[model samples]
Target: MNSFSELCSLLNQVSSADYKKILLKEYLDSSTDSDILWALYLLSGRKLRRSFDITGLWEILPKLAGLPEWLIDESYQISSDKAETISLILPVDPDEKRITLSEMIKFADDISELPDSAELEKIINILKSINAEDKLLFLKLITGAFRSGINKKDIAAALSEKYSITIISAFHFLSAADPYEDNPDNLLKYYKRNKKIFSSYPFCSAQNQDTASVFQGDCKQWLAEWKWDGLRVQVIYRKGELLIWSKSGELVTEKFPELFRLSQFLDDGTVIEGEIIAFSKGRPLHFSILQKRLSLKTVPVSLTDDFPAALIAFDILEFNGNDIRSMPLTERRKILASVTEKSADQEIMYLSPLLEFKSWKALAEIKNSAAENNCKGIVLKKKDSAYSGNDWLSLNLEPYIFNAVLLYAQRSLNSEMYSEFTFGAWHNDELITFTKTSGGLNEVDLIEISDFIKANTIEKFGPVRTVKPELVFEIHFEGISESKRHKSGITLRNPRIHRWHKDKKPHEAGYLSNLLELLNAGK
Candidate 1:
């Protein structure tokens, strides 16, 4: 546990990707197989079920530390992390023994089996026996909030370097096999033996079209398709079973039962990649409609009838139990068209139609009119390029931008130092909060904004501070709609900060009337 805590601290401090990979490799080399497996699992953004109530901890920690609850609450407001707050306030013991990561995990598992009184006693004893750093990690683990700077890509790269395997293979291994159940000593062997039907390949991503060099060449070398505004998924059928895997590697076969018709149509050992759009009356609906189905574990008949789902099959990755990723996209598209035509479920699965364009100018004009067809934009794929890397490029429509004044600042849940800002627009001479966004700010900008927020705070409401509405910012979003739930009577989709308007006055920001006008115009 001490070593694992140190590793997390070191990972948090480093900025260089290569150095982080080195640290990860070193940790893997030094730790036991069980410890390494759990560490990788946690670092890869997986967590055990949180067994204890966090609110209960907030109440109990004050009693154990002999400190006022208000002090702990205030410290939590500053840190924005419960683990850090409790670790800092609790009294530390000088004579504490080191614990292993597995032991700590086992303690967490044992919490559910013990009685409430026994659990509280165990927690108090463990807290008293561990150092502050270990205590922080243990608290985070039991609460299922153990997050670090490390990502799956970094871990895959470290494994690739250590095992002399390809990064893609390592990624597939990491995504497919459960580290808790699989033997770390036989990681490669198990990855090779695992059924391919249960695993999803690394999704092929797209670069922004403006930055890609493919456009500089002949337009004839590329194929254009409408970039659907829906969820990207990989449909897999193997061993007489069908599965739908999201881009994030979640098994979502049950989420869209309407797509289960593919099992009768698609051949065994075939994998098709496409977008799952909410279709109604033969047209794709907005992503907001499709999002309703994403969280449903059991889809009701009424919901399916209202927002029916369809797959716009665009590419074929595997055919007849063979990996065809290395094949040219032009060849794969031919195979894809043939496969989809034979499926017979044309309403549920349709081939994404290719856009015909003679020149880049014509293509640009078509891209500008993407929203008219309810598409995000256009995607360009090199006809001769393989399906492995980022041979595709996406040209998305420009986001709607609005200038608004910052109204409130609260500590961000994702980080300890940064704060999420709420911005408001003038509505009938009153500042009304419209949206809150935490993205699109660098570390330097975050620090500057944090300092500004501290100096301009007018009132405190627990973790949130009402700030003087003086600073203005440009906010960017995809769409807007009317809503009765908000005081502003409007909602913006996927809003994020675009830039801080240092020279603009609060009065110069946009008004609620303008947003309503834009929303009505869209309708």
Candidate 2:
């Protein structure tokens, strides 16, 4: 097999998530060969896709990090077309046999017998000759990430152990490596010595309280956030490198480039967590504004001017090599505030506003005005609280709203037969036989629906089975519109549950015809 194919095979097997540490562990003992490096590149992701097939040396090179098309080309058209040629230069065979991960490692070593360093350089240079389209794939191959398995956290740890450096340092090293760049093998086991408590820290949620008065008495300090309509991002600047990850644990450094610029003002090894909101000069931008920016693999210059993101620093997890997640919110606040550079921050950053509502009544009053001030709601933190559970309550989950769907029944994707209760809806039409329905069920109602599905499975559609639609579920939606995709061709906009009806009848529900009438009436 060709060296690149062997590398690809190795990457495909190692699980993109697990390969970082695994590669460090296996290759740390001695210097790596070209084939080994190639495997890393392919594993990292050396193909444009299953299509655009540049499986060869093209996938492992880095692109011009900060260049814009306008600067490179006088006519935007020429630059756009030429951009595709990048993939052409980094060619992989659609018809060629692909190798396996195990074979890839062995072949890398075998190819290592060749003019070792020269082959590695040759691969990297080949990658550079290609256009930007293939650089990511090229780097993935060289780095031994097939982009299929393995998580990056493990990879960082492996790098730390192999290089005998800090975990944050190892992340930087991996991110900075050139494709076909090889490091030592024993990297995995080497970095496990400094494990910190990444244990859960959160505020209590409103769901847990279940009382209108729960917000009335605060045993501890309390804070309020708008639950801003954006992403929960964690920015970790470690060892002269910057990484920004999302709540889902996906490293989204490239997704938002502007945030990375914070390294210029913040501590190199500090790790911070907060909400990342797309904003205008000084105001919170709409979710759509952020959505447009997020779609880009790299934010564009136009977007930079239009929608910039600012980190609303909420909590400090680590500082100066110390893991402080275990520290109380009160303590973390002190460290977080101390570290905030007065002159270093741009308009994109600001401290989250906090307040102590003397009573739940006060909190409710503030919540009424929160929308006008771009806040989600009031967050209550009990006095003397320690970070605890996985459900932010483990840390302490202040009553927060997370919109989820009821995925069963006629409206749900899972339990069509789970609930026997017929759902209720107001008549959407006055002039038609069917009724339109929506915007009734809230998140709680959906959970009730899910429970009904899970506990009462009977029939099956793929992995989903039926118990009964005995539970009448009303789907709450942001808006409703007619759709061809659904049965009535009536569509829901961001629909979730409004509430579960425990005391209502199914036929009393709004019919499709009634819904159409309502839509007409609203119009």
Candidate 3:
């Protein structure tokens, strides 16, 4: 591959977007015209990012020739205004063949014997000629900071399609696994060798079900659990050694080592998926326990003691060295239950307790009592069904997406959305008045409401002022409840993010039926 293509391939593997842009410019401006192929593919959406990051590309090139860490560091720190001169200059030795770090490192020892001033000037010009994106890609490659516009998966898919390979095969290629290893006769296999893992990073998912049937089908035989406001954990342990992963697919083992201890609670070898909640006594604890342990490099004795965590396992992905993810919900739960029972310590592996309901009314009862039960919300799993896709989002959170009328909204003084709102929170205790809004909107509705809030400000409720709750906001419901703490008689349960309503009037706010339907659907 030409230098630009090779560089693009490397850059495609990187995750950060900002860094990629920087390197892209550098390479494009200073790189040799012969290496223009890499520059061409930078916009192809067909390459992996590893070729650009100094760290990832280091394996390919001679270490000595790879851009110096100190150089990138010096260029990296310069102010944007000064970066032009200090960091990205014209390339040097522009006509020199693109060489791997391994090759360059070997050549480094012979630098004294090579051409001096002319060769040096050429390389500098090549560096300068590399376009901004290419330069950023180069800098990030050398400095290991290639951030690109797209993600690894997206790049993988695009490249897979371009090269006529399966997405999984593309993943294998990006990940450095030889998906085509068995097919040596195949020409593609040659290039496919030593492929990288496309990604271990979690991806954004669409959890919505287009034709979601809430009112129909079975509401009975449904189960409920308090959706704790903590991190979702997927624990994997083969033979003793355990690892905890977050929903975003990040390795959080270093973050919460105490959770690894819970592996001892299980009887045999197994992999379990559950939410890790703060626990006190035999019950789940508050989400606030996470604050102390989030980003710490070293585990503190006090923090570990302060926010002790527990796993409320729901599904069993792997057991006894077998992957059971494709198993039906009924089967998965059965295994999960069995694993918990077999566990030496019952507390380490407790079956997530469920509240069964026969109808929508039963589901509503459970949802209302969620706060009392210390649950953020309830998860409605269709019994005997298998887990699939974003079905989780539809089953768990959709019922709460009610068309609640905007009770009152005002322009927020916050960042993006220029409107602040006070709606409802449904807690069994006392549905308190919970509000959400933004003030950064420069739109027609925000412009109008921004004026209205200023004119109608009543009293300041700390950061939020009590405005005449006049405008209607169509906030989607995530869950509901009656909280004793709220000013609104009852609150909208764990409300989800949705769009603002500019057309609807305040008087048309949602009704009790709006919430009832959701409760029944959820149940």
Please report, in order, the local distance difference test score of every candidate based on alpha carbons: 0.81, 0.49, 0.50
Superpose all Cα atoms of candidate 3 onto the true structure and report the RMSD in Å to 1 decimal: 13.4
The count of residue-pair clashes in candidate 1 stands at 0
Best by lDDT: 1
Residue-level lDDT tens digits of model 3 in 1-523 = 3345354655666545555545454554555432333333234333322322133322222232356656545554674422232324324445434453223222322332446544343333444444444444444433334334555455445545555555544433443332213331242364455222111223322243322354356665444555665678667664454566577544566567666666666544466777777666665654545634654536787776765676788777666766566677778888888777755364455678776677776666666666554466566665655555333533233334433333345433334333556564334532335545343244776666667766777776544556665555556544554435545434554444365556665445555544555444533
In angstroms, the error of model 1 at 345 is 3.8
Question: Which candidate number would show the highest TM-score if scored against the true structure?
Answer: 1
What TM-score goes with each of the models?
0.64, 0.52, 0.44
| Model 1 misplacement above 4 A | 10-23, 54-94, 145-180, 192-225, 231-265, 268-271, 280-283, 288-309, 321-334, 341-348, 353-372, 377-509, 520-523
User: 98-152 in candidate 2: lDDT tens per residue?
Assistant: 3333343443444445574466554444444443334444444434433534345
lDDT string, candidate 1, 28-55, tens digits:
8888887887888788766776657667
- Report how far off residue 205 is in candidate 1 (Å): 9.1
lDDT rank order: 1, 3, 2
TM-score-superior candidate, 1 or 2: 1
